[model samples]
Target: LSTVIDGDRRMFAVTDFAGADGSAGLACDTSAAETIRAEHERTVRSHADTLDQLNTAVAIFDTDEKLRFFNQAFQKLWGLDSGFLLSAPSNTLLLDRLRSEGRIAEQPEWRRWKENLLSAYRAVESQEHWWHLPDGKTIRVVANPQPKGGVTWVFENLTEKMDLESRYQTAVRVQGETLDNLAEGVVVFGPDGRLRLSNPAFVALWGLTAEALKPNVHVSAIRDLCDQHAANSPWGGFVAAVTGFDDERRDRRGQIELINGNVLSYAVIHLPNGQVMITFVDVTDTVNVERALKDRNEALEKSDQLKNEFVQHVSYELRSPLTNIIGFTELLSLPATGPLTPKQREYVEYVGSSSSVLLTIVNDILDLATVDAGIMQLDISEMNIDRTIAAAAELVADRLDEHRIKLAIDATEAPASFHGDETRIRQILYNLLSNAANYAPEASTIRLTCRRLADAVEFSVHDDGPGMPPDVLESVFRRFEPRANGGRRRGAGLGLSIVKSFVELHGGTVRIETGQDRGTTVICTFPDKPSGIPDTPAGIRDAAE
Candidate 1:
């Protein structure tokens, strides 16, 4: 049969059939058949339009493995030209083109992979595959076989999603390992008041087993276990913090003393996700050390007070008897007192000198005690530098003469006068000179150099004698640590100590320069006007050269 539709001629085959009554019949229903064929074509077009609108790249291949249809996304995903996609390339040819373009990773068994992918055409169920493209794109491919003997391929870009999953897994693993190795006990509770996370330290600190601290255990159940270990448990607060509906959600920190004598410092932190994290650190040793230090400090203060008082009493007691002895010795040497033989006279002189030295030692002890008590006050005043030097030189003149040591005065650079406590300056110079005399070699010259600097006056006493060794020089200014150290005689070791104390009182510094075989020099620098603030002495140096 032939018909005309839309200006085009269509032809259909007619069939002749016989009926049950032996009659001949002919059938030609071309119009109804054309209508059904047109409807089916429209339905296929509608499905193709829907697939084109999807983000997933879709392609359809026929039983011949030739590409029949593809969406815009498929062209964009592979970066292929539209002309090439419309050329009806076979599935294997398409894969080969993509591989040659380096859009997909190279396959070691290319033929095998291709054969396996093509197997989806005969598969009863959908086949899934993962393709990691060379451009770092991950594509999830699903091949769904159609009832009419073709496959519909879906390509989903899952690179970002898979990357996010991988990073999340790594973060969780790192956090778990970090929490496990921490020294502090840590526990986290969910908003539902159930234990969500905890470390081994938390379990050990609470004296609980791993089973007792298992995930999903209620806070109240953990609280009961904590109460047995601690006199006052902090878990009660933790439970409220985790489950309570307070809007503020303030964090808290406190200390708890356990029945076993351990002290734990704890902090309650509220996370943004409605979880509570509690951390505990043991501070038992730290607390004990603080208490012991406080007690020792108090005892030391009391002992220092007793020592000051005892030193003052003993100094006064010895001073009175020493004054009487010195006075009687002088009286015995007087002409009115019975005339003494030369031996007797020498003995009296010795007694007087010995008493004087003892009195000086007692006075030094008293002065040091006053300094230790922090009550030593300087009498600040202006004094003639030349007169002070003269007086100190006179005081040590006898000793220098006995040692056959000559004093060299060099005050060419010294100021005429400076503001200072006249008595203390005199004492400072006297101590320096006396110390020099004690160590000066027989017939050796001791140099006394004084200079006026821009901001201070400097005084130095250098002795030409066997110098101190490293060991003796280390403690040269320490009180009561007397070492003969090649000196004519060992002193009470107060001369240098007194010098340091008095010079520092004027806000000055003391420095000793000495070494074995080399002579010793003691330098004292006084501020032009007292700074009124004492400082630690400057360092000692080895003056071997």
Candidate 2:
């Protein structure tokens, strides 16, 4: 029936009406019934609008299993058209459509699964399920039962959440495994001054049981255990750091020695998250090795000192006796002292030569001892290069003539005058010539060459004789290590050693060139202006060089 009431049009669906006496009657106002119907429609529209704005997909199915209402999110989540969604398809029909499109995972027992899912309409409580879709999406399906015999399905996408949880768990497992296999002891403490994490290595290093180092143990308790083993415990500092009471939150590293003779190196690190970590590594072997090496080095240095002192004492004692022997041999050879037979004169000559050779050996030893003591001062002066060379040759002339080896002097490239210790230069030249003459073949020519380079002077003594072997050349400059090597005779073996020492004192270098069947050449080079040696002892530096 339709009518105008209070200038407003109102309509109502009218059924058969009856009067109080069971007789046919006229229509009532029906305004109260119309008001209730209008309010119900406004409430339903408000609820539908709120549901449409939600992100979660929601669909309501009636007792007949047909979709009664759905929100906008439901359509978007399923990627379904508006026409199809508005047509109100059944829940089974929607599932089949999604399956056909490969959106949901395949079910082996499709019929049974569908029946169980549809059973939510008869259930009083809500049911939940997890759907792993073929498209790599995870959907949490909740079938919430309604009092009016329907089900409200909620599909919450949980793919990203599950992925994060899986990665976090994996990371935790990997960290645990890494710590368990490390050689270094590791322990972590929280800001509450309690232990948070510790590995087996930490327990073993501190000689504590696993039970004693369990989680949440206070730092003070661990300090007590440390004091029993370690000579100095660092736990007092650790407690302050973990409790946030330390003014400077800095990392520390140090070594700890145990009473049992073991040593450990430790490091304390502060993390940005207010956590502290302590690590320890065993260093007992390294410490022991260092101590042994130090002791051995000290013993070697003392032995060398004794050797130098012995050589100096022996040389000084022999000098006085040798001087008297040479003087008496000279007197006996002169006519004013006595006339002697040919055999007596020859014996005197032999005695004088033998005394001279002994004196030379003693003098060489004294010179070496002085150098070793770091007190040998060079008398540097300007000298004529040609005169120095001539004088050195005259000294070694008798040996060269005896061997029938000719001396060949080549000083065309030498400077007229050079600044150096003239006495040392003459001694250097004499030692070089003597070494060459000792090894030079009879009737062979020994070449002595001197050249002026850009900033230095070079002198070379070449001998035509069998050269030194590789083994002999290896220690050719060592004192007292003489090698015959087809030479005429062997003396004190200090010729090359003295040459090297004197040349170096004059700021010079010496090198040798030789090979099998090819003669040996000893070359020495001196700088133009020598860098004066320091007044202080330089024995260590000279020996090392």
Candidate 3:
């Protein structure tokens, strides 16, 4: 027998088991049919129990649009009595009863809403609606059209859920307000180094528009923008910190100076959920204050240096002619083949003396100019310290004699030899002695001492002259401030300055020890080996010049 079984425990279709005659009645198995019917009843009861346990309201309609099955939850969802639901009303009649009893919301156009809801019966796919009933409950209804000509409607109550979601959104809005108004820039990046959230302050700090900060932008793109505003960008560090998965995550903090003169302090913190939070704070005012003070000091020093260069170069260019004038004047004053009267002799003497004074001024200016130009190259070689000192003393011997200052050489503590520039060393010694000669009184003992220490050779000229007053000592090494106090002649004031400059050029130092009552001791130190680079600023020939 060939037979078909169905859910209602009834025969659905049959096929004849006869041969060519087609005369055999289907031999149905009564016992197997009873067994299939029992299985169907058990399966339907199990499904009904499962649906009753659900929170969602589920209702099914027959091919004629009459209510066929519904769980207890479905009745509760609509606040309907079980008696009316069991009566099996048509789908439209059920909706009409619910609408009349104020269970469903009254639509703006009732006939139109009813027609729309009824369209689910012929719909080939599912339809959904969020219904706000007149009883103040919200229902999320899903209408799924069946393959066999009917529809299944599932209603979900979402009133409490929506209320909670609304509160959460409100809290998020408040937090967003707080972040937008903060002065500190805040950026949150995901574990992939892609940007997740950034506050307005973060965008404004970098001077970028909000449109540039779209969702899921990689950290490198932001770095590129940040680097556009910074000379030496610190964004590379930020990118590395964001994408790093190292076992140790240390919080990083640093201060960065931008090309636009803004200084920002940044901190990167690793979040617990594999995100990185970076904060930037503008500290430009504090950093600029310190930088401004430092720049001002540097500017003043540069101005002073430039002024020295001006005096030096002009003096150097003028010295050659001035020297010729002094020399020729002295030659003319001498009686080689002719003799002059008393008045002519006086005039010649005056001319010679004035030329000599002018020559002295020109020479001072040239020496200072050479030092100011910073190209004062030294001839580094081993030198006889005593001989160098002797040559320097002889150069200033006449001035010493004119001032009545007796030169006393003290080499008791002196070295045999040292390594330095010979000509420059001689000049340094001569200038110090000349400075002392111009200040020392007549018959005063001017002592020259050379002491050899472990690392350097120290030379000192001690003059038993009236010491410099507070004001003169303050600017003792300033060029072109000529002041002769009881001396035979004033100087161009470049003597001490030259000594200091040349000493420093040899990587040495100069110092003065003097007070009102004490005689002055001007000390100059030269290193034994001359191993250090000169402390003077670098000299480069200008390309344009």
RMSD of each: 7.8, 6.3, 15.8
What does candidate 2's lDDT look like per residue over 134-221, in tens digits?
8788899999998888899999888889999999999999999999888899999888778989888888888999889887998889
Minimal lDDT window, size 10, model 1: 536-545
**lDDT tens digits by residue: candidate 1, 286-323:** 99999899999889767767766887799999999999
* Cα RMSD, model 3: 15.8
List TM-score per model, in order.
0.77, 0.77, 0.51
**TM-score, cand. 3 vs. native:** 0.51
Model 1 bad stretches (over 4 Å)? 1-57, 62-64, 68-84, 95-116, 119-126, 131-138, 145-150, 157-164, 190-194, 218-224, 232-255, 267-276, 289-304, 531-545
Candidate no. 2 TM-score: 0.77
Worst lDDT 10-window in candidate 3: 536-545
Q: What is the lDDT of candidate 2?
A: 0.86
lDDT of each: 0.87, 0.86, 0.82
The candidate that achieves the highest lDDT relative to the unseen native structure: 1
In what order do the candidates fall by lDDT, top score first? 1, 2, 3
Clashes in model 1: which pairs? none
- Candidate 3, residues 469-514, lDDT tens digits: the string is 8898777776666667655677766677777777877888788999
User: Which should have the higher TM-score, number 2 or number 3?
Assistant: 2
Flag regions of model 3 displaced more than 4 Å.
1-273, 283-313, 466-475, 481-490, 532-545
